[model samples]
Target: MAHQTRIPKLASILAVSALGLSLSPSWAARSFTPQAGTWVISDEVDGKPGRGFAIDVQGNTFFMQVFGYEKNGDATFYAATGQMEGDTVTAPLLRYQGGRSFGSEPRDAQEDKSIGDVKLSFRNGLQGTMQLPGEPAKDIERFIFTAPDAAYYQTEQWKTSSRMARWFGLNAQGQVEKSWFAMLKTSPTEPMRLTLSDGQTSETLECSLTTPSDSIRCVAANAADAGQAPVVKEAQFRLLGAQVAGAVSLQAEGAAPLQLLGINTRADYPYSGGVIVGCCANGLESFMPGTFGYAQRPAYQPSNGTWVMDDELTGKPGRGVSLDVQGGKMVMQVFAYRADGQPTFAMGVGDFAPDPELRDVSSARFSLQQYRGGRSVGGAASSGELVRDEGEVMVQVSGRTGGYGMPAGSLAEAMVQFPGESAKRMRRLPLQPWQTLEDQLFGEWYFPGLSYAGRPLTVTLNRREGEFVTNDDGSVRCQFNTQMLRGECQWPTATGTSGSSGPIELQDAFALSNSYVRLRDRYGNLVGLGQVPLN
Candidate 1:
């Protein structure tokens, strides 16, 4: 009988309303919609910030969607949608249609089954509010659509190529379990207020944004222990997107004044460009690279390798394009010849790596600047990192407004040509034919998942030789290299024992992230060691 493994589950909430407007019979015939789009989370009372929501009206009914981290202890999102009747932007707890959380997958939580009454309202057709029924204390939140995309073009962070970000709200123990994502568009003129909530206690602080040498600084609107100025008792922000500098700071004047280092989150997925991420493809549907931040193009210098053209495209800019690299950097103007012999700007991506020691030709990032009749409406960007051959770099520029985030990330795709004519354009390009992970796996790897089991395995591999040791009684030792599967092993081929190693083989050699591969036998067959890493 196969054992039943348990999967992680998320505990979260989902959500909005009020304005006294003309409720007439003609109101049903008249169309009603928001004045602006991209309503961002601006303020929250007795709740968390960084939550963005939207509203849509159809005839006598109104629909809503709430996004971002909720007050619940769950560190992930508590997104929910609802509908109201009779021209009122209000709904009972039962009116909530459906919902989903962002972190762990749903596991039949009672929180998803229970919802409190909600009151919603819009003012000037640009702002909105969501609260509990009849009372103001439950929760009152606000979102504004007219807010600009602050992380791009206009901000100091974007200008300096600091486009990547992840944030969280910390507690007094100097801990930040739940992430508090703040993608904000603040008033450059007035004081920007932030509500820091830790489930039980809350602090409201007025902050001023100052620019000194293009670096943005946030200072308390009022000095500490002096006036009505609320102090920022606790907060943890880890800005890890910069190329040269990154920090995890806890800025509480009287409390922990430590400028710390090391891992912040439990799962320390590489934050910097080192650990490439997949295409964040869940929410953002209308993203275009270079318009906002620099998009990335990952590559590995193949010594004397050259860029191949996928000229199947004959449209504007040749539909397909490949970049030329010199000294690990691309030139300003890139163009490709069309079928008619006319040259047009070519833009696309590829992946290949030589050695990090010789020349780090592993990745290249770019940003697209979009223009409509020479006027800039808004923009978005992408990133291309060193990915395996199943090989793809899922570049989803994350945001709150305009549905920038989803279960995976945001989804916005564009096709670019690669090396061969058969190699078509794809935003998520996989260089499976050119991937090399043999050198990357040259160190010692311990199987953490198997530590608790009866026999834990310790694997040590190198370019020339390797060994697998069973820690239990130190009873087993298997030495194998690129040429041979098993150099030596105790109790080999005995009843109920591990099989005899044979000619070395590694299945799906490129997908190491999938963990432990099939370890075959002398005649090249499964040794029951498959799924060993995660098993």
Candidate 2:
């Protein structure tokens, strides 16, 4: 019996040795495929919430997809592939290809120049330093992936987590009551649908998910709101999970970006500059294509804690600006000059009430007094009390743009008459690489110099909330398919209005020219699509 036991033990030892040798360096370095799912990641840095890593595993590696607003209020999104060996993960960023992919291709460093290599050595719970290129090593804490139907969602824990409520838009109930969003199942294995209703109409779109396993996306969808067909409605959310989801309608371009929960969706970001000065003209940028748009603007820089604005135009006579805020008092001084070295400086001093609480939302109202410069110099008229409405500096920057030349100080911003049309109508946006294109499609349809029914008239197409209508004040045609999704607009009546003429039928009348929209009917075809402009 003892001999038999020894033989068995020897056999067991041999088997264990064989297993250990097989799991040597070669085997260990192969790959570790983690369960694919949605990961809500954040840091102890500010405790902000953000969606993270969606990965798919194959035999020896994983394909990755991540999209979100970063801490700095910029967007980060891309696709990549990487390998995991134990707790170490390393991969290079790749260009995003749609549903179909050729996974066998080698990583192209030149082609995928936008994204850098991703490497990390993690401890337990997947928390570690993400050593990305260019950026310093980012410390990621409590970074873990969970399925859409994560256990925390089923319970009440996630809702109580700070920032999570705001991220999901539970805080928006204070603004509007009927904010609605739903996760829909179109087919058994088909991609899920996220539907948003904005009273007048609803916009439905497929979730930005490629796989049916588990995923989430950062997206902006066009909503059929009370406005026209091109009116865009946006809401950010994790598309799936057992927990009840929350969403808020994002504010329009000119307003501060509504928080997209975990993503930093603030539309207007802070940019540091010096001071603003306007003597003869408030030099706001002109969007006109020629000489006006190319005019030189006064420069500004920070001096100690105050700001100095100077046109620095060697011989061109204009104004120098000095702006300073000490304690709660603000002063704006415009130093003007004549071509013959004559001086016409102006000064406006006022008090600014600062909020000890909610400093970001503090309001500032001031009426700049014209202490000098009543003369018209070099054909430019100058003088006025410029009243700046009180509001948070950040809010004022976006809510009142194009009026102040990028915050450093707009020379024409305070001037009432020097820049009349351009300053009043111009709307400039902070430059961002991530694009939202809905606004490019709205406005009037212009078919220049036309008289229908031998009478002077204008033909206009109206796109309002899922309805496209032809509104010709003249004798123009308005025949449409009458069906919404069939790609047609509102039809003109059989009996003509005073200036009404032929009723031209149209199919897919709305045509796109990069950023602008055009009406494509008989009038459009005759006049040419490119010739028709949206004013």
Candidate 3:
């Protein structure tokens, strides 16, 4: 069978109010502190956070209430019956909803307390009938919680003894009789190695991590080199919990320290222009490019930083719009077109009815009609999808797989136009074609359902030989240059419709269309396509 996995959600128990029958009279006799606070765990898989409540009844019965779901946003809760002997407690499931439960099979256990010589073994399988409320209970197709190494509470704060003693809890058990992992950095001069140890045997893999700079510095070696130095692009591992320090750097402006603290390193992933992450390791989300600090608590606070459009947008047929962004708020000024192509709309954050031609304003997703090709429109809203064809945008961030964290990275994007349009006139519009995974595509794309925008399932493609390939292993290992394109489509019509008047809702109504295409090197570094028009 394949590996069964559970994506971690770093959700904090906001609150827990348990009103129930008192513990068994025999339990009350002992000194048992029913711990009912918050416990956070990071799922290294999705880079998103998961949350739940842990309620100890009379220090004997363990109740675990999981409120967070996977990327699909589902919720699950389970209760187990077991005894707490000293610091160790193992509970079997008596009743479970939204979890894997066989006819009378018990779920896993939860222990806020630890034992001195604890060798806790956690087993979570997909061998039970399950349901998602409306769906009938069936054997789960994939069991992600079976990872054996997924012991809980191996936090970064735990001292060497805690780590060596295996004092932490295991979330799930892996199928691999033995599993191992090694850690490494992404710079050329950095020393790194991969070490693996099965219960009885151990192995270590060694290699040099190089960047573009190293390739130039060693030209003589390049001629006789077997191949390009193996660049450590992405790497990730469970920390139980670890104190991690991270930062984001880019050539364009806008990236600054984000000041995130106490993030469960679960749901962390690299995206187009930035990284998606969850704090406290509870729920999953994304972070714009910048620096980050991780641990058991918040490390810093964020400052109010803002930027304004370089020039004023004069409307089409007229002048376009002028805009500014401050403290997360957007300001716009509209000017009408003049006979001499001068500003016709109002200047300086002008307040006027929005453009009538802008269709489906309230919809979550919208389509770009068409743009005059090769024109760079200025402004944040004007920054649409980055396309690979033009070689403009590229991906700069990475997931934790390579120790290249998935939080706080630069965010930027650009749009493309149809080939037949004039460059000057096309510069006035925002809608364009195809999206690219550039340094700006670094942020994220959120879909309420299985796929994004309810059209074509978006996948980051690494261009092989003028074609696209999926990062199945989630790592980019190419012998030649490649581009990472964040592909999404425009919903042109409805269930069976074709053009603009087809579908009203975005769920599954989108027709095939290119949002944007980003360009990247074989090592997964972003290379800009063209300049965005600021005025």
Candidate 4:
């Protein structure tokens, strides 16, 4: 017979304050928010396949849910929610039963008993330690199935951007049809590349932007290798805000030259320029980079802000959801009315996993927990306690468009299920109007060194009385007009370098966010502020 270990149940909650845990002095100088995602005991992710922990952090509030097995091999889950002190959080884990499950009638989950107090201390966003009752502390880290591709791009010093554009037109049978195009640009000087695919075959095009006309002209980049006449002889595309309008001329060996007008089916963010590109894909599909080698899929982080259902924008505004995604983890809060028309909200935190059915879609499932009996508005130090399990909510995001075009990861589709209710579809509601180029450009920023071995840079800008000025004592100063996405900046020249004394002309200025910006200097070299901490 094997000796089995069992989790002890407690009638009373442990007082964590009596533990007298000390806080780190370094954490006082900088704010460190633990990345929200699946966390597991270090080196035990594969060894313990059926057990792990999911942590969701909203501001300073940390919620953790642990899924494991009982001594008899029955599955069970424990949850704890508490405020974080510096980089540490301690709370009493609670077990609940008799809650609503799939296809069951609605019933509140009652607290069964207190398991024990659990303490979580983070060394950084990706690494941490977890201390469970009656067990030794274990090392932990964020569970990453695949590393983000953006990290690879940064390591290789390759500046890249990408976007998705839809093309709609009448087909050969005179029926309306639509297709998608993935646009990628390596650098300012590199030719713009366009990829078109139909789930099976793909085509590539090398394009250039024609000045004055402001039209993108493209030629087949892979036609000759296929031993076939180029399907696209010439293409002229003009980006109209989020919508793209263009005409493509096709050539075939046995067919006459044909011209087709193309228009997009949906609206998106305004176009900035080629520098707005990111790593080669936009979640829809991946493209071969040819010379760029294998580029991993970038981890998708939906824009941080409030999101409402698209259909509910004009009505009385009954209910809405708030979404905040950080470091690949997502925390969603759904606010709605209860049975008696009383307002209530439920929140969940989890990681977005790749969807099995849709190649371009990623979905996250959350065990929604409702908290009650906490501090009131303007009340003294008190915390909320989870009172019941509300239900489950899942959000599926696709076609993330951002980084100079819109807010990065701005658009997505979602579904919510509460207890016995069926799932409902929801789309991200666009609340704010599209920001002007000036609005995007005006902000304080911090960027890592542009050179391989240079110090980080901090930049502050303000526009006063029709003029832009840098508030910092930095060597770089730039000015630009809203009408054109071009500017001129005075930058320091390397010692013993030969160049004109005149200011360097810059173009393709794109503000991906208040903290991230990209530009191209006259020499076609890349210069921009990336997401580095200003502090």
Candidate 5:
């Protein structure tokens, strides 16, 4: 467990007093919202696998369902729902029985009785504690399966990394519009470029990197009319995680400068240069992509793909869920084990709806069903019949939009109930690499428009070395560690003698779907895009 520092009460009071503020009752209280997802007992995670709590919070209402085992190792579940005060909630734990099971007819589970009361106290969004009846308080935390990239290509080598930015401002007709910005940036030394589009026309601008005063000066990158004044003068903003909020100064032709408040979503660390800097030219405010009023704005959608429970990827027999969304309909299949340890599955199909209070969250509820009498794979033909109303399942998908209006930062949590059992919480698994460094890069590659002599170039690479042969009988060799993704390549002069050598960098070599690797020089200029043929 990670250690956390606790501030002394007297010290906290002294610190607040030093800020020259009165210690009011409201000011002394702390508030927190528990992030909705799967949580586990921190210390007992390894010893007690297959047991966890699914917790969800909307406003001050808290809901939790625990799945575990009885003394004889029989499966058991419990549920609790209550309103939270500050950062804590206590509620009665209830059990149920007589729910429908696989191959069983439709039946509703009935509440058996209250077992005991449970207390939950949250320290923050990700960490908390839980106290069950007859058990000591246990430390609990959100199970995080996904971790961000630990390294990135330098700006000098990549030129520009593209990301989607959410922009909010009034269009040319003086009506507010929520749109997207194609934000492009190199390193701190290069100017930040932005292009705002409403799915029709677009406006572009170039702005300096964030200044000391937390502002960026902008100028027209492309002007419709020559010798015209720049469309944007300046912008001042703040960056919090992936969110950007601030105000911009827009200059209309023959009009006074207009100050418009705006907010944008930015890429994660190192790419954003730790500040908000973007702009747009032309009359973008007048063009709204969809409707005029914010009420008619389109909701963000989650991308359709395979999702897994992050912490449970042990290549062992465990629970998993498959989600398929088509238009407004969603179908989920959960594969797990029965109380007697037999493998079983439940399916749910329903419609997706956006959360009224959370812009980034969408949900669906389905009547759970199970099937039986199915044929085995590659066996005799057989049909399966559904056992309706086996239970209920609810899924919540949370995500954000990025470049090309695609889903980014997508996360999902599900509350699943079986007849006679309590709901269980499950979360989408994080991305995992399926290929090795050698599998991705060891081969012959072709680069077109790579030679100064106008001849196509072909390079052969092994685990440790790469050779580039020129059309003029000149050859250069590079030595690199594929695991590091960096190397040095020697340059041959006109006389066919080794002249100079510089560093070589490649990006996204192990990307699962990539057919090529981006090659760049030490100064970040594009050397060639190396493509490998399909086997």
Candidate 6:
């Protein structure tokens, strides 16, 4: 086993000291002077944290990047806006990305190139304030300069671990119960989901930002909760880079008052410009074997079980192995040995977390056992955390041994399960690259679809393009690249005999996808079939 490094106390910001930016000296005066470079603004409400970045240009324009999270980390909020010089900086209302706070209404047609005035003034030596659409006064925060940081400056990448609790709804007991605390990994667009141990029962939950703050609501991805009630939570803070600072928090509607969390910042090292290095903790590990998706190998032909390591199992560990277990968990074992086949390093075992990527179709679990020629090592207990996003989960493991030597062989086993009722609701996922073309071609196609009215009939999909032309007699006329086909299709209302002969009356309504073929049916009822592939 490799030696482990000593970790610093939680109170120390040494790891990300350089990544934390510093506020302008004039923050105490409540006056701000805009700078012409990259800077960060941080906020704290209740116990949550939110971060914002600004890239200023020639004293005339400034681009802003904002991010915020709820107490559970699942309520992530973020946006990008630009401001220009004027009597006062009037920024466009902020919006969220990859989050679900924005209601169903289509987003405003404003373009990113549209620049507006955004005033910047300091409030104190380390505090500042700004205004948005709904704010009565200015929103307050602290600014940090990231270029000159000691640790973050020297380190090109770093990682931090944080906890998030999703507030679904109150329980029957009236006590505020939360889903599992989720682990959040932040990197520009590549965020990692980690695990949260709640002592007794550990569960995986998704984490995201809802809004920058209660005062300035950012546009979210899904706004099903729009016009509902609000949530009350505070904001929290942590400095990550030199001259740069950040914050996180939660916002909700109804019942409770909006609560903001803790806010704090510290000085960073000098500018050591290069690349920003990311960080990771031992408690977190990836579940994907090498590249994701499917891979083909000869069936496990018994005698061909000669294990070998893939780059993914880098560092230590002997010949690597992979197996599938139905939804619970899996245990794998690896043995390290000298070239002579004599054991050197102690046997090691890895227990993988349930696979979140496939949680919808199936769940997974993993376990690792160390053995020397079929003998057990006896001291193998591993722990893992599950970072859940709607359906999938990611597991990380840590192993230990008193003094075992390397052996000649290793093995890994996995379990995949389908949680009939305990599974979380499945969120519609983004399509894969190859699926994009199909998604467009089959855009609105619906089989015995649910949204349509009246008696629904099952519809078979053939070809599709932009407009879906339906016949006056209640039939489907589909158009593909240049090919056309007719079908006596039935929607919710009427069922018709399948035939190919007809002078179809293609209607004005174009088919986005065949969910509900829009037809001016003078007297027929409508029921839509679910979507399907033409092939």
What lDDT tens digits, residue by residue, belong to model 5 across residues 1-535? Answer: 0100110000000000011112112212222245444566676444212345556553344556564444443334566666566578898876555443443443334455776899998776557899887677889875432211101233322234444454433334322223334454545456677665533345567865452333344556775334444455444443312223344456655543322323232232232222111111000122235765222212222322233343344443244454544324454545444444343455455656554555444567767654454332122323344434556665654333322221332233443344455444544332222134333333333332133433224344433332332222335455554444444445566787775443332321211101122222111211211111101
lDDT against true structure, model 3: 0.20
Tell me the spans in candidate 1 whose CA falls farther than 4 Å from its real position.
1-165, 168-179, 193-212, 220-254, 258-280, 284-413, 417-423, 427-535
Question: Evaluated with lDDT, which candidate comes out highest?
Answer: 4
Question: What tens-digit string does per-residue lDDT give for candidate 6 at 412-474?
Answer: 111211111121111111111112222222222223222233322323343433354343333
Model 5: which ten-residue window has the lowest total lDDT? 8-17
Instruction: Note the Cα lDDT for every prediction shown.
Output: 0.25, 0.27, 0.20, 0.42, 0.41, 0.22
Tell me the alpha-carbon RMSD of every candidate. Answer: 29.3, 27.4, 29.4, 19.5, 25.4, 28.1
Write candidate 2's Cα lDDT for 1-535 as tens digits: 1111111000000000000111112333211123222222233222222223433332234344443322332222344444445556677653321111011111111122335686665442223456554545656432222333434233232222111111222222221123223333233345445455433455655554333333334244554556545222444343221122223344455533332212111111012111111111122232335554312221211110111112222222122233333222333333322223222223333433322232111123343222222111111222222223221121111111223333222211221111111221111111111122221222233232342453222334533332234454423323333332122222244564334322221111122111111322221221110111001
For 1-535, candidate 4 gives per-residue lDDT tens digits of: 0100110110111111111222223333212345444566664443212345656553344556564444433334566667566678898876655443334444344455777899988775557899877666879875543222313223222234454543433235322232334453445457667766433345678876564344567777886334544455555665422224455555555543322322122111222111112211143233345654213333333433334444344333234455545323455555443454333455566655444454434567767665554322122322344456666677765434433212223334454444566665554432212234333333443332222222224344443224443435535455554443333344455774332223211121221221123222111111221111111
TM-score of 4: 0.37
Q: lDDT of model 3 at residue 28?
A: 18
1-535: candidate 3 lDDT, tens digit per residue:
0111232221111011222323333321211122221222221233222232222222233332222322222222222334443323444322122211112122222222211111111111101122222223223111123122323112121111111101011111200111122222122233234332222333333433133111101111111123333222222222111111111111125433111111121222122111111111111233344634321111111110111111212111112222222111112222121123211111111111111232111001111111111101110111111111211111111122211122221111111111222111111121111233222122112111113332223233333322223344432211211221223222323364422211111110011111221222222221110111111
Candidates ranked by lDDT = 4, 5, 2, 1, 6, 3
- Angstrom error of the Cα, residue 420, model 2: value is 42
Give the lowest summed-lDDT range of ten residues in model 1: 1-10
Better of 3 and 5 by lDDT: 5
Q: Give the TM-score of candidate 3.
A: 0.18
Residue 416, candidate 3: C-alpha displacement in angstroms: 35
Who is ahead in lDDT, 2 or 6? Answer: 2
- For candidate 2, the lDDT comes to 0.27
Cα-based RMSD of candidate 1? 29.3
Model 2 vs. true fold: TM: 0.20
Better of 1 and 2 by lDDT: 2
Which of 4 and 5 is the better model by TM-score? 4
TM-score of each: 0.24, 0.20, 0.18, 0.37, 0.34, 0.19
